[model samples]
Target: MQKVTDYFNKPLNLLPNYFKKIGLGFILASVVFVVSVKISGIHPTAEKKEMMKIISKDVVLLGMMFIAFSKEKDEDELTMLIRMKALASAFVYIVIFKIVSDVFGIIDQELIENKNGYFFQMMIWYFFVYYSAKLLR
Candidate 1:
């Protein structure tokens, strides 16, 4: 037990698990969003804008829970700045990717059928940024 714990507590191992927590968070929130849609018997895509408004809050709560824990160890100011830059880039990329996919008509229902679309993309982006940060460091 001690050996296992010691191995993971290494800075390297801790990083992946931290990002994995982010993935789990997106999955949990997505499940709630999908289940809510099914149980409510409201599949109104026309009302989708309103639906997003309702569930948008869940993203915040999930972020607070998952991302808050990812910062378990104190980082140096330089490292923190690098992370902030990475986050900004991640945000821009998500926005641009979503827009381009929508505008170019490249995506279809399969990718987003159950709000899983958002969650799926989020997982991919988190890992991209997470690993990129690791490599940059």
Candidate 2:
């Protein structure tokens, strides 16, 4: 049990800090592409639109993963502790969101149908918690 706890508590091998900038670039590019397409008024066929959406979402997810895995400028014990706490909080938030949405039917069925959206929401929640905790501390 102690070993298991230690393993779980171990800090992850994060990517280089520079990856955060690359991730931001990816996210910005995706947003720009989408906005450009929309503003250009080039109405693609339904299939094309769906493909674009999937691609854009994938790019955004990739960017987010990069950002999440990249190390902070000063990676230390406190930051690791805060990261873990933020992750746990985000997980709890997702569970609560799922339960409440299911019980109240507040969320759109379409959004729930897409796992990418669900995972994206989790990432968003994690960032929110992580940044807030860092700032507050």
Q: Which numbered prediction scores highest in TM-score against the true structure?
A: 2
Per-residue CA lDDT of candidate 2, range 24-102, in tens?
9999999999999999999999999999999998999999989988899998888888898988988998888888767
Per-model TM against the reference: 0.43, 0.84
lDDT of 1 by residue, 6-117 (tens): 8866443224337547746775777687678779987677678576755755664465436523553545555555556666666777787777666555446454344435
Model 2 worst lDDT run, 10 consecutive residues: 106-115
TM-score of the candidate numbered 2? Answer: 0.84
Q: On a 0 to 1 TM-score scale, where does candidate 1 land against the true structure? A: 0.43
The CA lDDT at 65 in model 1 is 37
lDDT for model 2: 0.88
Instruction: Find the 10 residues in a row with the least total lDDT in model 1.
Output: 11-20
